[model samples]
Target: MRTAYSVETVRTAERELMDRLPDGVLMQRAAAGLAAACADLLRRRGRVYGARVVLLVGSGDNGGDALYAGARLARRGAGVTAVLLAAGRAHEGGLAALSGAGGRVVEHPSDTSAPFDVLAAADLVVDGITGIGGRGGLRPDAVPLARAVHESDAVVVAVDLPSGVEADSGEVVGEALRADVTLTFGTYKPAHLIDPAREYAGAVGLVDIGLGAVLPPVAELEALQHADVARLLPVPTGESDKYRRGVVGVVAGSARYPGAAVLAVAGALHGGAGAVRYVGPAGDAVIARFPETLVHAGPPAKAGRVQAWVVGPGLGEEPGVRDALASDVPVLVDADGLRGLNAKVVRARKAPTLLTPHAGEAAALLEVPREEVESARLTAVRELAARYGATVLLKGSTTLVADPDTALPVRVNPTGTPWLATAGSGDVLSGLTGSLLAAGLGARDAGSVGAYLHGLAARSAARGAPVSAEDVGAALRVAWRDVSEEA
Candidate 1:
């Protein structure tokens, strides 16, 4: 699992490590790693010699890291220049080191052609304008320099994190640096794993400064890896029969959209469920595509013995929605079923209740605008989970599953593609997750593993081509096989 820590936790760990170590030891270790990364990047183009390296230095330790790294580059014959954002408060030690190593300093860069030209012709630009401590966008004097960096063809490497991003929230409040690669120090911040800010942080390289031993065991956010997913996946044994393997009951589709039932059933069939019992008005349509499915024309309660239930895809506010929710089995609600949802009813349930909502549905539930939900996905998901007292999976560019209690760290789905923004995709996810729930994975694990498999399958099926929901559902088998074999 890939874990991310909050800024408070990171600072606490850093301070603890610093107290035990000698003066300048931590900073030196960080600078050495930063310099080595720059050297490697410079080597990729040709060599460190004669390469024009520009450092956008701020007043913080991030700038210190850049300045020291630049001094290392200067000694190797690279023309290193530092453009100081805060000329008065720059790191004194880093500045002296760079000057001693024969590096040039350009304080308070002008908007004129000279500074612009220097930035434009540079082979690489190390962004140290702001790190995790930065609150909003760049300062007024730094805007032009940032613009020049973006306009330039030079490879951008961010120090720790991109400037102007909320490290803890993964929220890009204002103008932020977009890097080709980010070399972060110590531990991974939440922004490095979550979206919006995560998008700005391209390929992240962790520079271990031995902060791991001091970091807290509890992470702010967690993402499951391949081996983690493999362990969570359901497997069959010699003693296992269809009933023992677990059956998933799906209550989906209507007279208007029968295809939703077929798609949902398709996803359930591949999610390690021994049998799928589909109950809805779209029974005929589901049977046509999957004859293996046990079809029922009645309500979910009458569907006969199911380990878990997936409700609401194309349900269109059907009365049977109530019956499914009242069941003593785990229930997953999606699409139209999420409409007019009651928090009280969900909270009253003895069995686990999982709510899957995209940005719009999440907005409706939170009584906020869709843009608000999209902008602060982490906050939105957690708030919804807390409000409803249920496990909530907020689906979007980055899928997040929040634990109901808010005590456990939220699970972020790392595996996904832009092509997953198709119609009926959420329905497929709902059914897949329900199957996992039936197979006895907890709400968090089921939702996360289902999302992982769903994304992997979508990528496998799409392969850069346009794919339908059916294609994604069909590819689940391949995803399952790949995970098991690879593990």
Candidate 2:
């Protein structure tokens, strides 16, 4: 598993390393990695013979790394130029190395956009702007320079991190530079993993400066790989019977939308649940798809048995839907269920409750605007979990799952395609998670497993084009086989 850390934890680790290492060792290690990456980018294109390179140097060590890296590029027969933001505060050693290696320095860049014009003609741009120490937005002099680099046709490679983005929150302030690739020191930051800012970091490359010893669990979310998810899936033993496998109960759908019942049942059956109890008005349609399902009329009270319950797919905001949710059994609330339900209902439940909300629904639960939820997904999901005293699964381009009691890191689902956004997708996920919960997984595990499976199923269903919800359900069988074969 790839772990992400907060800015504070990384800074503390860097400080510890700095104390133990020689004076300039850590910085040199960082500069060496930066130089190697720049060389590789040039070599891959087969065009470093006389290519021009521009470095946007800031006031901190990030700028120093870029300046020094420029020196290496200059020595390799590339024309290198440095646009220094802080003329006097620039790293003395880095400036000397660049000048000695035949790299030119341009001071007072704001005097003219000439440096930007030259930067536009360069083959590659390296942003060494404000690093992890930045508190506020970009400085006055750095905005237009960033815009110029952004507007350029060159392949942008950022040193340390993309300038003007929050390392911890992945939030963009003022003007942020978007890079085609980012080379970071030590370990990965939360912004490099989460959304919004993650989008700006086109492709991320990590350079180890050996800060792993003190790295804490500061990663807000992580995208699970195939092997990891496979280990989490339930594997049946020869001694185990159907009863030992676990039974799941689904309280969903209505006469108005029978397709919801079929889709949800499809997800549950493939989610490793032994027996599925269907409690809703669309029992006839569910039975037609999976005759093994134990269908019941009325509320959950009459429903035969359920180790885990999935509530609120198609059941509208009627009083009956809320009544069904009253059961303390492990429940996954989604679609219409997320609309009117309050945190009090979730807290009152006896079993663990998992709430799955899309961006708009999450905004409603938090009483914030949709834009705010999308801007900082890490904060929004954690807030929802803490407030409701339950696990929250926020669905979007980057899926995030958070638990309330412990800050045991959120999950960033790496699977799924745009085709997965078709109708009835959440319904499929609700069934999958409910089945996992019933099969004895904890709230956190259930949420993570469901998301992993759902994304994989979507990818399997639609190779490239758009696919229907039914297609996704049909593709689950292959996903289960593919994930199991690796084990």
Candidate 3:
């Protein structure tokens, strides 16, 4: 699992490690890594010997990092120039080192156009205008410089994080600098993994500064890798039978949208479930598509036996929402089932409950604008989970699964692609996750694993082209085997 810590936690860990080490040791370590990465990038573009390097120096240690890295690049025969945003407050030792190494220094001019000539000619730009401690956005004085950097053809590399994003919430409230690459230290931050802010961070590279021994065991966010997903997936033994493997009951579709039933049943069949029992008005449509499904036309209460229930996909004005919610087994609620949901009723349930909502549906449940949910997904998901006393899977650019216990790390699905944005994709996810729930994984694990496989399947099916919901369902076996092979 790839984990991300909060800003406060990282600060505390850094302070602890700094107290024991020499004064300049930690900064030097970071500078060395940054310089090496910049050198590699320069080499890839051409050669570092004659490359033009520009550093945007600020008033903190972030600027110091760039200055020290600039000195290293200069020693390697690169033409390095430091554009100081804070001429007086720039790191004293860093400035001295750069000057000793024959690097040029240019204080930022009041007129932003003055730096345009140098910025335009640079091969690489190092952004140190702000760090993780910065909130809102860049200072007004630095806006023009940022504009100049963006207009330039140089490859932009941000220090720690891209300037102007919230490290803890992954929210970019105002204008922020976009990076071609972001070099983070110690561990990843929530901003590096969640969306909105994540999009600003292009490619991320973790530069270890030996903070692992000091950081906490549990992080604020966790992204499951292939091996982690493989471990969580359910595999049947020789003794496993249809009933023994687990039965997933799907309460979906209606007369208005029969395809929803077929898609949900398709997802459940590929979700490692021994059998799928579907109950809805579109049983005939579902049977036509998947003859293996055990179809029932009655309410979910009389649908024989099932370990878990998936409700609410294309279920317009259906009656099974209440029936499925009232069941004692684990349940996954999505689409129309999310409408008119009561927090008190969900909190009262004994079995685990999983709620999957897109930004729009989540807004309806939280009584906020859809834009707010998309901007601050981490906060919204946590709030929803706490309010409903159930696990939540907020689907969008970045899929997040949060448990009701806020102390646990929110799981972020790293495998997501924009290609999975088809109409019935969420319906497929609801069924896949419900099957995992029936197979005995906790709500958090079920949601995370389900999202991982769903994303991988979508990517495999799309292969960079447009893919339908049915294509994603069909690619589940391929995704399962891909993860298992790596394991």
Candidate 4:
């Protein structure tokens, strides 16, 4: 798993390293790593022998990294040019290195199209604009330059990170540099792992600057690998029978939206749960799709005992859902269940509760605007956990899970794709997680494992094109096989 710490944590780590390492030692290492990455990219394109590189140099240390890296590339037969955005304020040492290495510094482009021309002609463009020190949106001078970089055919490589992006928060405010590959110093930042900044940083390249140890156990989102997910999965032992594996009760669907129940059932049936007990208005539809499910109509009271209860998908504000929430069992609340949910009810519950909400629902539950939730998903997830006293899962391009009470690490699911935004996707994920929870995994493991499997299943189902909810459920078997085989 790859974890990202907040800017404060990184700053502390960087300060500690600066105190220990010799002066400019860390910068040299960072520059060397950046140069190596550029070489790798050029080699991959089969034009390392004569590739032309453009460096958009700003005033800060970020620009210094790019300039020093350009010197390295210039000595290796690659043509390099640096356009000094801050003419007089450019890093003196970096500029001297470039000039000494036969690289020239060109005047900053006054015409908006000039940078685009350079970017279009070059094989790769190095973005050395603002670093983590930047606040708000892109600066006026950098906005057009950024847009050109993003639209150009040339690959962009960001130094440290993509500029104008919130390094600690995943929020993308105004114009931001979009890099094909981002070579970062020290460790990963929240922006590198979370979206929409994650989208801008296409592929992350971390350079170990020896700042790893000093960083606090920061609140962050993490993406799990196959081995990690496999480790968290629960398998049946010799003494484990059907009941021993555990039962998951599902309270979902309404008379109006029966497919939610069907899709949820589909996920639960293939999910690690030994048996899935369904209680809702859509019993017939769920049974029609998944005959293996134990269906019950009326209420959860009539539904047989279960290790965990999944509520809310397609619930549609019915009174029975309130009763289901009142139960003292491990429960997952989603969709309609998140609407007007009381904090007292969650606090009063005896069983552990997991609440999964999308941006809009999360905003509603927290009494904030949807834009606020989207803008600060990290804060929103943490806020939800603290307010409701439950494990909160905020679903988006980067799915984040945070447990309340302790400052434990948050899990940011890496396997999800934008393609997973299809209808009934969230329902399927909830069922899979509930199944895992019922099968004896803790809340953290269940949520993380569910995310990992869901992403893989979506990729498998798509197979290159669009896929329906049914396809995702069908593809779960293949995803499971793929993980098991890897193990």
- Tell how far residue 115 is off in model 3, in angstroms: 2.2
Backbone clash pairs for candidate 1 read: none
Rank order (by TM-score, best first): 3, 1, 4, 2
| lDDT by residue (tens digit), candidate 4, 1-487 | 7778777777778888889888888878889999999999999988766788999998999999999999999889888888888889899999999999888677665654555677778898998988887778688877877877777778899998888899888888888888999999878888898888888888999998777777766545566788888888788999987789989988889988888988887887777889999989899898887888998885887778888888889988654667677777788988988878899999778788899899999999999999999888988999999899899888997899888865688888888567889999999998999998899887777887887898899998887788888888888888887888897
- lDDT (CA) per prediction: 0.90, 0.84, 0.92, 0.85
The numbered model that scores best in TM-score is 3
lDDT of 3 by residue, 233-349 (tens): 999999999899899999999999888888888889988889999999999999888999999997889989999999999999988989988999999999999999999999999
Q: List the candidate 1 regions with Cα displacement exceeding 4 Å.
A: 109-113
Model 4, backbone clash pairs (residues 3+ apart or across chains), number: 1
lDDT leaderboard ranking: 3, 1, 4, 2
lDDT of 1 by residue, 1-487 (tens): 8888888889988999999999888888888998999999999999999999999999999999999999999999999999888889999999999999999988775554666777989999999889888887677777778888899989899999999888988888778888999999888888898889999989999999999999988888999989999999999899999888899999999898888888889999988878999998998899889999999988777779999999989988566778888999888989988998999999899999899999999999989999899888999999999988889999988899998886799999998789989988888888899999998888888999999999999999999988889999999999999988998
RMSD versus native structure for model 3: 1.0
Model 4 residue 119 distance off true place after TM-score fit, in angstroms: 3.4
Q: TM per model?
A: 0.98, 0.95, 0.99, 0.95
Worst 10 residues of 1 by lDDT: 108-117
Better of 2 and 4 by lDDT: 4
lDDT for model 4: 0.85
lDDT of 1 at 409: 93
Using lDDT as the yardstick, the better of models 1 and 3 is: 3
- How many angstroms is residue 133 displaced in model 1 relative to the true structure, after the best TM-score fit? 1.6
Please estimate how well model 3 matches the true structure, expressed as its whole-model Cα lDDT: 0.92
